[model samples]
Target: MKWPILQAFPSFSPRYLRPFLRLCAQQSALIIGKKLHALILTTGLSATQTSFLLNTLLHFYASCGDILSAQKLFVEIPHSCKDIADWTALMSSFSRQNRPHDALRLFAQMLENSIQIDDVPMVCLFSVCAWLRDVGVGSQGHGCVVKMGFEGKVKVSNAMMDMYGKCGMVREMRRVFDEMKEKNVVSWTVVLDGVLKWEGVRSGRLLFDEMPERNEVAWTIMVVGCVGSGFSKDGFLLLSEMVFHWGFKLNHITLCSLLSACAQSGDVVMGRWVHVYGLKLMGTEMDIMVGTATLDMYAKCGRVDTAVKVFECMPRRNVVSWNAMLSGLAMHGRGRVALDMFPRMIEEVKPDDLTFIAVLSACSHSGLIDQGSYYFDNLESLYGITPKIDHYACMVDLLGRAGRLEDAQTLINQMPIPPNEVVLGSLLGSCNSHGKLQLAERVLQKLTEMNPLNTEYHILLSNMYALAGKRQKANSLRKVLTTKGIRKVPGMSSIHVDGHVHQFSAGDKSHPRTQEIYLMLDDMVRRLRSAGYIPNPASQVFSGSDGIEDDAMDLEEKEQALFSHSEKLAVCFGLLSTKPGTPLYIFKNLRICQDCHAALKIVSKIYYREIVVRDRNRFHCFKQGSCSCCDFW
Candidate 1:
């Protein structure tokens, strides 16, 4: 196959070298690339071959993420003689460097020079548009694809679908996907991710169920969606089915998502198993993402020591690693330790906005008002990160908890953006705690005006009126709510026993064990009373009544009504079903009513056991006649 010319010179001409170098660059072979460069220099073809060889080198460097070298070589290529591939290569390099704006500028320059658009440039532009969420620019690129008769190309169409999805145009993404003559796994994964990120887990699950063929990516996407959307149980359930029933091999991605689900659900036992399996499967060379997920899992599962061990064992640490450890410490009420890690984080990884948010959250939970305030105020100055709405909300919570209601209000008013429902809700709760009736009323009024359909604000206002001894006002509010068909939300509680969840609502007698629960509650009350516990009648004034009735029958009815709150029944059920010295864990869907809180304190002392109850807003660990919330929540 040897040619006569190659036999004569024993080598190809520099003119022939161009195509060879271009091919080597396209294939991304460093060995062939260096050999080509040396051959050009040995032939004394520097002046003649510099431009083409440099362009080839630039392409190789850009593809390998050596952007500095690529940029230096690109600067040597004269703009007047640059080809389409050179322009495309530079745009792609900038895009990979996270400089989308620079890529767009280069695209504009290429267009001005009348360079014909190709699939590579179109994909690069679409990628930039996706990153910037610039739908208009993306549509313009689509038009170019159509005009160039490249609309039938699968790769180009996939890029378009990805652009629409990342820009949150789910309907458009589906339209493009539906129009495709054939669909691949990538097409399905991208659209599914869009649905999960924008619509929710239910939508993603629906799409997944309808999919004819499933791959590992499809399973991972669904699992991640479930965990992210607060349906961690569903995620774990799916993971179990995939492994045992579907016979899918678990990979790093699968294990990572499952670990996140366990962390979020606070399933420490399952998390430990996942950790063991991950070590056996991945062989301890865990990526940063998997390490972070495991650390977060341990922290949320109330095992800060385990989280610390994972963090220490990680081969490399990033900002997310530090944030995970700090967040775990904060969740476990080890705020001092979380704060102590801040300096180390800055020294190691240079904390970012999310890092600050985690640290600030720890401070807020620990009631370190001054520390939280300091970090919040200096976020922009110290880290060049502006405080977002969540940060402001945490600040409001911190100030509100410290009983500095006026200061919190002032801060809310001074915020660059208007306060959202969370900020207002935090303020209202603080007012209720401090008995600041007037301020509570004002905040409620504003909240109702902003969101008239919100039932929670109406309930809060009604309770505020009752606490202020304004029965007429409370009654009027209740009447309005009744007319609007807005009944108060029923209080419900659940306790896990023998791996099954048992739920109860206020005044509920539907459980099969109802009679036994009632009997147990009665006996517990007697034991608590004998231990010098007195009923806190102050919480019985639902209608602002003194609860001391003129008639004995009316007093008896009031006492009966107070005993039927859902938390009380759940506590009773826990006492009867669980053994002695076992800590009872109850989850309530609302704030623990004042009566329930006092009763539980007495129950804890009388039974000589600790009861941990997590309510809507805070945790109440009642032991020895005291609560961790200090009777404040």
Candidate 2:
């Protein structure tokens, strides 16, 4: 298919050869392009009158994706022969390769030398600005565009809106969009994306419905935008709308967004749907991103077995894929298995900061205090990765949970970065669990000073006072919270049945089946008593004080408090609704109190069921009157 342009023109005339080189450049013919570069250098055509021949060669190299060759030629170009196009060609090449830092440096050099750029190449500069979110440089580019009179160009204006949006100046983006004389689909999409970033999905949806025409990218962006904005349920609906009503085919981006929504909401049914949709669309050609997201979805939804299947069957695994599996195991309290994967991970793939975090978290949850310490010590020395705040948080939790509070405090004091709320919170939680009130008081003092608005720490301190029989101190703190309008966040629990998520709270009787659920609870209590499950009376009084009255009033109060706990209600509902001995999974918004954890262990043994519960901090798997955490959690 190679054309003989030079053979036809043996004299190598400028007119004939120039036309032939331009054709080869447009075709991006690398071999012919190289021959033409050699011809120009040997004949000294570039030095005779102009460097149009050299510039054409530059375009040819760049267009063929030979960025290194194009950069070399541009560097060798004579100062007199170089023009705006020559500068733009090299800049565009770097920008297209995602080397924005290099691209911007070249732009700065162009400005220093006063090389004029037309509107077309200005798009590349604006794109780099958008991606980097460099407001100062972008404003300078905007000023230059004004001076050069490219203000009315649609592509330039679109890029400007994108840059402004990424810089968090949504008002300026809207102004540019309003001022533009002509607007295209890209302009609308950019504004829509900006709205999603600045606000929520509702605003973006309004703009999307108002658009004159929508392309595939615009539709996909809208769907992903909802997931990113934390309106994951809305994201799922939009995906359905796109496929069913708009007749848009499901792409990798759309599927990944949907999987994220499924994970956030813990909607296993919808996750299965997305999984099926992926198989239907790709049919043996699974995208690694889609597969990794699927693994994440299953793991977060408490189906670790399914996640393992997906991980094993994946055609390929990247670092992210391995991290997802490790995180999944850590989250679901399979810390032993999670730790087992580490040596294999080191053999095959390199572990980063996130990998160590997952490893430390697994060790913390499983009471592998020694293993957690080993990883924390070797994090920098063995892995050559600096320990971030999350890794430090896991270590603090590890030491504090193992009753090494002094070591935990020393680690915090020795942290390279200032200890944040999470590190302090982990220590405080361990303090509350192990009855270390003095350290709790000190941590609370620092926390309250750091964030006066945070009532959770205040509540924790108050609860500690209540537990220690300092009722006046607890009452005084409660009065101050009421005065500051800081009400405690009520704990909530939810269980997924079929596709619907049912919620329960302390004393919650809002469900239509409340009567049936309560009746089921009564039956469960009768059976539990027969099987030697007596309620722990200490749970009723916030104070763990000695000498409880066995009077009728005291007994009634204890019974009412124990029965209305949110997790108990959710568990009773699951027991009644599902088949016998079926595995039940529940998610709780707060840490599982000691009484609830104790009650669930007995319930599991009596009912012959396995219950997987995820509380605020970690997972608890109850079966046969035993918990996976072995009373350490």
Q: TM per model?
A: 0.67, 0.72
Instruction: Write down the TM-score for model 2.
Output: 0.72
Off by over 4 Å in 1: 1-212, 221-241, 244-247, 283-286, 303-316, 341-344, 373-389, 413-422, 445-454, 475-580, 586-595, 605-609, 613-619, 631-633
The lowest-lDDT stretch of 10 consecutive residues in candidate 1 is: 543-552
Give the Cα lDDT of each candidate. Answer: 0.77, 0.82
Clashes of each: 0, 0
State the displacement of the C-alpha of residue 160, model 1, in Å, after optimal TM-score superposition: 9.2
Q: How many clashes would you count in candidate 2?
A: 0
Clashing pairs in 2: none
Candidate 2: tens digits of C-alpha lDDT, residues 1-633: 353655777666566667776777688788877877776666555555336566767777777768989988888778988989888888888888888999999988988997777886788888999989998889898998899989999999999899999999999999999998999999999999899889767888999999999987788788667655545566668778878998988789878877887776667777888899998888666898999999999988888899999988887777888999998888777789999888888887898888888889888888888888998898889999998999999999999988899999999999999999999988998898788998999999898888888777777767787678786786677667779986667778888775557788876799889999999888877887887777865564442111122224466677766766788889988988889979898888777767778888989998899998888766788999999778877
Per-residue lDDT tens digits for candidate 1, residues 96-174, read 8899999999999889989988888998998899999999999999889889977677778888888998999999888
